[model samples]
Target: MLNFPLWKKLMVGVVLVWSVLAALPNVLTPAQMENMPSFMPSKTINLGLDLQGGAHLVLQVDMETALKQSYEKMEDDVRAALRDRSSGTRINYRGLRSNTETGIHFTVLNPADVPTVKEKLHSALTGVFVLNEGTNIAVAYTPEELTKMRKHALEQTLEILRMRVDEFGVSEPLIQRQGDDRVIIELPGVTDVSRAKDIIGRTAQLTFHLVDESARAGHRLPAGTGVFYELIKDEAGTVLDKVPYFLVKRPALTGENLNNASSAFDQYGNPVVSITFDSRGTRKFGDMTKENVGRRMAIVLDGNVYSAPVLREPILGGKAQISGNFTVTEANDLSTVLRAGALPAPISIIEERTVGPSLGADSIEAGRIAVVYGFIAVLILMAIFYGGFGMAANVALLFNVALILSVMTFLGATLTLPGIAGIVLTIGMAVDANVLIFERIREETQRGLSPMLAIDTGFRSAFLTILDANITTLIAAVVMFGMGSGPIKGFALTLSVGILASMFTAILVTRWQILAWLMRARPKTLKA
Candidate 1:
């Protein structure tokens, strides 16, 4: 321990210098950071909602509606699969509809057609159960399948929501599942609450359907056909009027084929959203447009018609645009949702909260005072007990704090009030390692061992104890971080990082400092 190699000393010096450099930007103002050279590290620790006020939202996903929609789509697929003329099996079906409680129900025209229809549906639907009840057939999903689907929908919803929030430029937003069908979103530094909510809540389900001109008037349609109204709103978003459009119940194209979307201005300076499709969508769209030239194609979003433009020619490039009377913000939001993809299910805001900047300021100030006081208290106590050795421990403790902050900044971890408390706790624990080593050294010296021998034995003996203690605590911190949410997770993160940093500073850094002091002074009898 007394003799330090040249490379080891250089390694220690390099780490401390790099940590300080990485942590330097946190103390600088925005203008100062901007003015600094690009080579310098400019990353800073992200502040949580408690430290920087913003919006807090609790959302509940409507799984029932999602299940209903899934069944309805499945009903359409079943009808189409059964009506395939190339299958060689002739079957007739009618009254195809989905019941919320009974799944998809339809009537077979003949009893003998039931077996073929069932076989066809089984081939079409991979993971669903098909049953025949009297003359009616039902396509049902098992509980396990439904549960799996719901779980997937929740995970997909979280990803899409995260993408949307990130595109909105809300840095370090906390979005996590709270319960079976609920999510919590904390957006720090968001000022436009209404716009944020609107973006989060919109489903953005875009579809293309053909207009049913034959069902205009004096014509009776099929059982499931109905009219959908598209509302016209004023600048204030008040419903001024509504236009009714009759469309086939099934859509020719859906948002699932979307590849990209962006907001742009038309030649007339009106905002619109331009969209592009993937390869398969391109083929489908090209075929549809090629056959439907001179006919109207409805551009519908979330059951509302945006436009019904005549297909002048084949759009082979798979690109289209939706033009509506929209402001720049509305168009931007629409594009954002389209790019993020539609949510599998709708979400409703169950709770909303806003924290003021003044409160955040107050909390930050209080936390700073607490950390300063706790640090000073530890420094003074160590100095009084261990004399010159305490000064070395103080240096290590300071570096330990810097290392913690540098790692957090680099990882983009959010710092909350509980995180501050964890740092304060770390200050106390950091000195404990030094105290153990110093006490062991004093005991060795009392036994008439030389300073060099005592120092070596002390470090060697205390190493296992420190490792065991810190390792156990680190494990606990890891568990807490994995299982906890929000502030608890923040606290666990700081504690885990602090434990690792303290192990480095207390054992290696302070040991190097003491060895350097002994080599320079060459003290025969050490007081510390």
Candidate 2:
């Protein structure tokens, strides 16, 4: 234990130098970092919502709207099933409609067609119960199926919310499900609260519907057409007028087939949203445009028509562009939401809070003060009690902190207020191993052992004890990180990193320092 290899010493030196350099960015101002070389270690620890101050939102998912949408899709499927003639002759149907309360209901014109219709519906629709009374048929989702759909909707909403937040480019965002129908979002460093809310709440449900040219907007004589309005808004987003459009109820294409979307400039240098569809979407869109060469296809988003462009030719390659009189920000936001995909259901913000930068500054100051004072107190106490060896321990403690910061920065971990508390706690615990080893050395010295043998025996004896204590605490930290949410996880992460760093410093670093000193000084009696 007393013998130190040259390679071990070199390894220790490399680690210390790397840690100091990696942790340097935290101490430097942004302007100073900019002045430094580009290849230098410039990444810093990310601050959490509590440390940086941003938007806090609690959103409520509208499950009823989701159910209604599902029923509408089911109604469409049922209509197509009755019309399908591949198996046999098409069965005639009438008065087909769907609602959340009554599900989907339609009547078969021929009583003899009921059995065939039932068979086709059963084969087409899975997880639904179908019943028929004479010529009337009612279809509803099973209880298990409803539960499954709700679960799936909630999960998809969470995933889409995460994707939207990631695209917004906020750092260290905390997005998690709060309850069955609620989502909690924390966006750190986000200044535009209204814009964030708008982006998050917009459903971005995109669909393409063929325009009904013969049907007027105000006069509704068409059976399978609906009146949709296109809002003409200025750059400030205030609607000036709403031009009504008569479009087919069933969409020819939906955003589900979209592969990618981006904001780009048109031929005239105007901002537009360009979209590409997947292979499935490419085939369907090609067929639709081929069938309706002279008709207009309206791009509807969230019940509003954005554009109604005429199909001059069959568009191939699955690419299309939406040109609206939009500002660059609006176009970018629309492309972002489209690329992130639409929310399965509508969500409303039930609660919202904006955290001020001043509060974050105060919290950071408070945490810094606590860490500095606590660290200084520990250093002073160790030096006063153990003399030269205590000073070595204090040096090791500093390196331990550097290691923790470097590791956190490398892992891109978020630093919260509780994380600071963990660091403070680590500062005190870092010296425990040195204290134990020093006490053991004192006992060995009293037994008249040589200084070198006493130091060696002390470290060896205390090694197992130090390892056992730190390992248990490390396990607890891992458990906390795995089981706890948001703030608790942050605390646990810092604590876990601190434990590993402290072990490296207390056992290896301080031991190396003491051994090097003894080899040079050749002390006859230990001062520790």
Candidate 3:
């Protein structure tokens, strides 16, 4: 099997090369050629959070806000189901904690409303909502229940945030829910974290409500009621006082169904993010505006009304356009948010850090000197020990360097300081495999074998020793990647990649070079 026909072996080589090249772009960067547009992915390097310096946010998303909203919604459902209220009503939250003090209470226009209250609260808080039956109806939630709900919402919001960040097109982002109330977000290569913060922090909720006419126009609602506003601010040159206000309901028309949001040029070359929604959102939007034709609807985002366009006719199709004061980049970003839906709760940044470019440059220079010095010292030691075949082995060393760089270029991996260290150590390890093989060859030659037999015997016998050494080191790198954070992970990844590349170069590449040299040059005897 090993002595297969030349063309058959070459055919296999061609297939292997093609297979590697086809899959190479996924793992290697240098497989694709530059200056051609067919398959070249944007060769931009992905910088780490420390190197590129992006936003580091430690935010607490108030799950309590969602809880209050949930409770209020249930209360509203109860009120509506009661038909007509008894002229006046007062309801208060005697929280889960206050259950021992003052239980949940509701006073109606008449005390007769008390009996019906129990029936109504029972049906409304059905899902995971526990009711403690006593002389009076105690509609209290438990702390554990609240925690459970919060965790569910927190996990959900984290997934949603990941989708939103993907839409934003940040290179390598870290978004995960932390405990019960907070989320941690790290965006690498974001030049302005403030802009990202503003977008992520917004609720981006849309709503529709008529102006409460016939009385004080700008006056706020009563204490318990919330008046949702479309807030606005003026530019430096623009008049701020002229900004008008409008109202929208709390029931938000979410942008979650939006499938695509991209900036396209109008006939006049102005920028706009073309929008499209999913099937359900399309029907809901069309139904909402069908009856209220000619009425104005505000497109509210981040508490500000961006556009207030009148509904000339129903928009039955899932497609529409968002046009505002926007550059191409700004329009694209706005569309990204709209396509990903609104955030569950507004976020606030509590922490940030950055690394300077000068420091990174300094590290690179130091790493270069260390690698060069290390390579020279190893070469000197190898030459002194083995005399002639050590030089043949040195040829193998250069092949290892080529293989590692070729793999990196093909994989599109960003080179870090730690990654450079991994490559340097890998170069030294490459020689260790060759030294084992060379020593084995010498031992076999001394024990009465021809030069060809000795060389073949060396590689065959040395295979297991080389495999064991590399395998153990590879396992250590994997464990380091698992336990370590950030920079350590980079080192592990680089070392793992280096190990694979080194193995290929040390075994296959070195053997191929040696076989060609032996057959063509025909060395007479072993040089040990």
Candidate 4:
């Protein structure tokens, strides 16, 4: 009744065989797969964290500090932009320099030099901080006017975190910004989770400060501040080099200015990081290089200097390349950091989870035991009761398993401990459609029909019942999927796919096989 073309049959068989062969590598030991060619398809099921020995962490990024840093940067920008226009007038911030209700009210001095001071104020504040020329000019900012400026620092910090994640090279990584100021990172298979934590945990924020030219020649750093530099040591542990505390000299150089950064070979064919900056950044950078031609400008992050080089001349053209004593990996990582920009906030690992390989093995064993026994009992009962039809049902059951694996592999889905239980449940349900079909066939034969006709009748009548039962089960599985988190989702996914595959194999494939048998024998009486 449902004969397939010879070519179609060959194609189907080939697909099934190739899929199994392709997947075989995944099922084999890692060492075996490694020995095989890279083009070979992997067959092994990807284990979830519960099965794989790995780490899980829930981190909280500090947004408040990020906000303060952003505000401070704006404050500094305003000061310097104004100071650069100095006719050198003395001014003091009056009480309540800013009240920031409907607008920002910054009270300042220089009553006599109103026009010149207003010109300087106009350069930095612009439309946001308008002046009211009185005994002391009061500048006020409009509501929500500085929102974009406020978010700059935090946004930069978040960008840096994304770059760091890329550097770690974890597959199928999940890094996302959580509520307001937090970030969530889920690495499925990680060996050294603590190392990752250490790298990301560092704020890596860099700042530049001029020598405080107003202070005395022999002046020491103020109480709150101290000079910092990289304390590099040789084998004897002697201080071999020092890079300074500043990330960049004087004016701020935000990571946002960077357009492209990549690792490539220099003229000597050594690894180097090439960088390109935006128009505005190129000008600022050129000015900085032009001034500090002989001094070492520190390339610092999280208080440690990565490099400090003396400028030979102004690095113009908005383009430059950094060549350092680094391997290819190091150069690439630095380039990635430059590419990701910066984070919006400082992030710290607050909670961590590490599942040992031993524990994972135990979990797998326990799951396997539960699934094996659960299906074995049901399979045994089916064979004892239904004879030939029962064997057909077992075939369908195997098909269900194959299809489930195929679907999972196609999706690149992870298998968890609960997911194994779902498979076992599927094995039991695989027989349900067969049982219904065979029982209906028995009833049709009792109604005075020949064996072939009765078998046909059984399938037609029982199809609806099989569909209804599977659909109901599917609904339940969907509900479970909704309720579950990571592991639960795995189980629900497997169960749902198994149910669909079971319907096709049990109702259609087995029905067609039985029809072929009935056509050949042309029996007068039904076997059941």
Identify the leading candidate in terms of TM-score.
Answer: 1
| Tens-digit lDDT string for candidate 4 (360-387) | 8899889878866886777678788987
**Angstrom error at residue 193, model 4:** 2.0
* Winner of 1 and 4 under lDDT: 1
Off by over 4 Å in 3: 1-62, 77-126, 133-189, 214-224, 228-232, 236-249, 252-299, 304-332, 355-384, 406-414, 440-461, 482-485, 512-528
Better of 2 and 4 by lDDT: 2
lDDT of 1 at 55: 92
lDDT of 1 by residue, 250-345 (tens): 887898999999999889889999999999999999999999888878899988999888889999999999987888999999999999999998
TM-score of 1: 0.91
What's model 3's TM-score?
Answer: 0.69
Q: Backbone clashes per model, in order?
A: 0, 0, 9, 17
The Cα local distance difference test for each model comes to: 0.90, 0.92, 0.64, 0.67
> What is candidate 4's TM-score against the reference?
0.72
State residue 198's C-alpha deviation in candidate 4, in Å: 2.6
lDDT of candidate 2 over 334-362, digit per residue (tens)? 99999999999999999998988888889
Candidate rank order under TM-score: 1, 2, 4, 3
Expressed as tens digits, the lDDT of each residue in 35-136 for candidate 3 is 346654434435456555566677777665667655655555655645544535443322222222232444444445555555656656654333434433
RMSD (CA, angstroms), candidate 4:
6.2
